[model samples]
Every structure is written in C-alpha cells, then in structure tokens.
Target: MKVNVKYFGAIAESAGKSEEVLDLEKGSSVKDLKNQQIKKYQIQDADSIQIAVNQDLKNEVELKDGDEVAFLPPFAGG
Candidate 1:
C-alpha cells in the first residue's frame, strides 16, 4: 500500500520536505509507518512526534492505500 505523508514544523525541516509518498507493505499500522519513516529519515525521538491520518489525529490507526499521513513536531507558540 502507498500513503501520502505531510510534515509540519520541525518535522518538515528534519525531513527536508513538506510532503512525500510512502510505499508500505500490506497490513501496516500507523505506528509501523512512523517507525519506517524515522529509520528512513534518521529522526530522533520518534515517540515524541505527533501524527494525523487524513487530517484527523490518530494513535494506532491502520493505514490504507491513498491515506494521507501528517507528522508534526511539538509546537512552541506563545
């Protein structure tokens, strides 16, 4: 399955892009995808990241083809 990923804030800077397409194996969960991304991007502290699927926040959602995943770093706004 292939999914679209969007990066925000520090996540985007670390990834060096705002969006990307990820090719994942069948039955891959959101957590699995996140792990793969962390490995691919050499992201540190993957557990502290925030994620959304198709614009909705998710914790343990399963991914499907054409799903949009967003990775966001911790926000610090005053």
Candidate 2:
C-alpha cells in the first residue's frame, strides 16, 4: 500500500521537505509510519507531534492504500 505523507510547520523544517509518497506494507498503522518517519528524520518533540489520516487526527488507525497522512506540529495562537 502507498500512502501520501505530508509534513507541516516545524516538522517540515526538520524533514526538509513538505511531502512524500511512502510505500508501506498492508495493515500498516499510523503509529508505525509515524515512528519510522521520526527515526528517519530524527524529528524532535515526538511527544508533541500529531498524525492525521485523511484529514482526521488518528494514532493507531490502520492505513489503507492511497491514504493521506499528515505530520503536524504544535500550533500556537495569541
């Protein structure tokens, strides 16, 4: 299964790219991909990172082919 991964805010800065397509095995979970990317990019503040699948916040959700996964960092507003 192939998933579209997107990085936002500090995540994108750390990754040095906004988006990429990942080829994952069937039954992959959001957590699985998140952990891989975090290690791959050495992303900081992993505890604060959030994963969104198909526009909905998800953690252990099972991924499907062509799903869109977004890596979002903490956001602040005054």
Candidate 3:
C-alpha cells in the first residue's frame, strides 16, 4: 500500500519536503507508518511528534491505500 504524507513546521524541514508518497506494507498501522517515516528521515524522538490520518488525528489506525497522513511537530507559543 502507498500513502501520502504531509509534514509541517520542523517536521517538514527535517523531511526536506512538504509532502511525499510512502510505500508501506498492506495492513500497516499508523504507528508502523510513523516508524517508517522516522527511519526514512533519520529523525530522533519520533514519539514526540503528532500524526494525522486523512486530516484527522489518529494513532494505531490501519492505513488504507492512498490515505493522506500528516506529521506535525509540537507547537510552542504563548
């Protein structure tokens, strides 16, 4: 299965792109995708990042072919 991924803020910078297509195994979960992304980007502390699937925040959800995923770094503002 293949999924579209979007990155925001620092995550995007780290990924070197605002969006990308990720090829994953069928029946992969959101966590699986996140792990793959972290490895692909050589990211550290991936657990701190937030993830959204098809524009909705989710974790452990099964990914479908062509699903859109987003990775966002923690926002710090007052």
Top candidate on TM-score is 2
**What is candidate 3's TM-score against the reference?**
0.85
Q: Regarding TM-score, does 1 or 3 come out ahead? A: 1
What TM-score does candidate 1 reach? 0.85
Candidate 2: Cα lDDT at 30: 89
Worst 10 residues of 2 by lDDT: 52-61
Backbone clashes for every candidate come to 0, 0, 0
| Model 3 Cα lDDT, one tens digit per residue, 7-51 | 988888888899988788899999887887889888766878989
Q: Which has the higher lDDT value, candidate number 1 or candidate number 2? A: 2
lDDT of 1 by residue, 9-33 (tens): 7778888899989888888998888
Residue 70 error, candidate 2, Å: 0.3
Q: lDDT score, residue 25, model 1?
A: 87
Ranking by lDDT: 2, 3, 1
Distance from true location, Cα of 31 in model 3, Å: 0.5
Supply candidate 2's per-residue lDDT for 12: 97
Q: TM per model? A: 0.85, 0.93, 0.85
Q: Clash number for model 2?
A: 0
TM-score of 2: 0.93
